[model samples]
Target: MAEWLIEEGIGESRAILVEDGAIVEAAIELPGALRPGAVLAARLAAILIPGRRGIARFEDGSEALVEPLRGTLAEGAAIRAEIVREPIPEPGRPKPAKCIVTEAPLRPAPTLRERIGKSSIHPPVGPDRFEEAGWSELLEEAASGEIAFPGGALRMSLTPAMTLFDVDGALPPAELAIAGARACARAIRRFSIGGSIGIDLPTVPSKAARQAAAEAIDALLPQPFERTAVNGFGFLQIVRRRERASIPELVQWDQAGAAARALLRRAERAPGAGPRTISAAPPVISVLGRNPEWLEELGRRIGAQVRLRPDPALAIAAGDVQSAHS
Candidate 1:
């Protein structure tokens, strides 16, 4: 049976689905996750290029796009809207969550926890299994560029438009392609990778060989996906629904943001109510310095002052929390 391991961390919630002793699905819910099916009372913010894209401002100062809704919306006019899609995190930008004008607006926005409870997946119960399976190590591996399979390896690259995978190893062309396809599918599902994906396999000479490779891919990837057959150039494209940003996108491009978040999470779990100091790389410290709300929350939660120290030589992802002596 597949088991759910949900951890409510400081600034985020993480879920891992373990099946057959392996993590198959992993999801991270950040603070900004806006659940689908949520209705809100919003005001029209702008009508840029009217009839195509208009922006709405929610009560909490969050904004969503009102597009192709069939009528002119005067700027700053009040409107009721429902979120058809959840807000996805983009690097250093607001989530472009899609909303449609609704006659009935939900009073309170549904939170991530509430949505997870209502998901097809059952509510989490019993002891945690995340640390038992060394999930942190797995997370590190997923963020890395190169991932290894049995005989070959896959190099994953994240592009602005799509994610790319290059398959290369010592195995034969057909065998290597099959193995790579299976591995790629597994990686895609495990990391919750979405959007356009292109896999470059070793050039196969015959049509039958390419067909076989495509079959292997089809057999592995789950439903609700569209894929193109392997072309003569040994390239295949697969498109998956992009509900939210991929794990790599959340971690790789924003190391400083991750570091700042890590500092806050660590502080939340720190021992005692004493003042604490966080030491991290200069960039990480700068991120925290710029955002005093994080520290203010930490102070409110622990009832103590928090200090940040910059270590010029520390790695961007590394951080240490220490208690003040006095």
Candidate 2:
């Protein structure tokens, strides 16, 4: 049966839609992020585009990019704003959360459980259901931006503008283009990627081949998305409603944090645990140490003492959990 297997992990909540014993889609929600639909009371911090757009400073000192502002309102004027999109992390200048002026009641961001309401919620526990559903492979793809299909591979690159996928393999141009397009579409859905996307397929001279490649994307990708036809240059663009960071964005933004959270999840499921020792790189250990509450909760859940050990030689993603007896 198809179901969303949710795992409320230490620092993040995750869900995977499993169908026929395979993951079709996945999502991760980090705590404290300003999810869409959250309303905040704030002051106009700065006027970016005179009367049309400005910055809103919340009471907590954080700021969001607010738009459709009243031209009469100057800086320092209090206003209620509703978040339309979460902050997007980029190379140097990250995009701030986006909001619109509103009179809606101020409400905290919805929790993952609340956001995914009434869905077939299967709280996976005791066993690592996510790992069983190729979770590690998904994370690897998100981190490395390399996905392998049968006859070709997709190299995804994240840019300030859009996510680009370059398809390459040892196949005929027409055949590879069709297969790569399908693979790219599946990966987009699997990673919950949104926003602007560009796919570069093999250059096929035949217009019919280009149309077939575009059709492959349409066959797999769901609605609420717009895509341009495959052009003569074998380039296609897709636009999806982006509200929050995708899995690749989250992993690439802070690899150490991603590793830390993943380690915590693994430690929670370690076998025959008494005093569990988590060994990893210093940065990853630092992330875990900063969150003592997460460690305490891990201990409480596993009925053991959680310990952190930093190894300079260890890679961030090479964290290992060992039982006291081991």
TM-score of each: 0.81, 0.96
Best by lDDT: 2
lDDT of 1 at 206: 86
Model 2 lDDT tens row, 257-322: 999999888887777747999999999999998989999999988889998999999987888999
lDDT of 2 at 249: 92
Model 2 TM-score, all chains together: 0.96
Give candidate 1's whole-model lDDT.
Answer: 0.77
Per-residue error for 258 in candidate 2, Å, reads 0.1
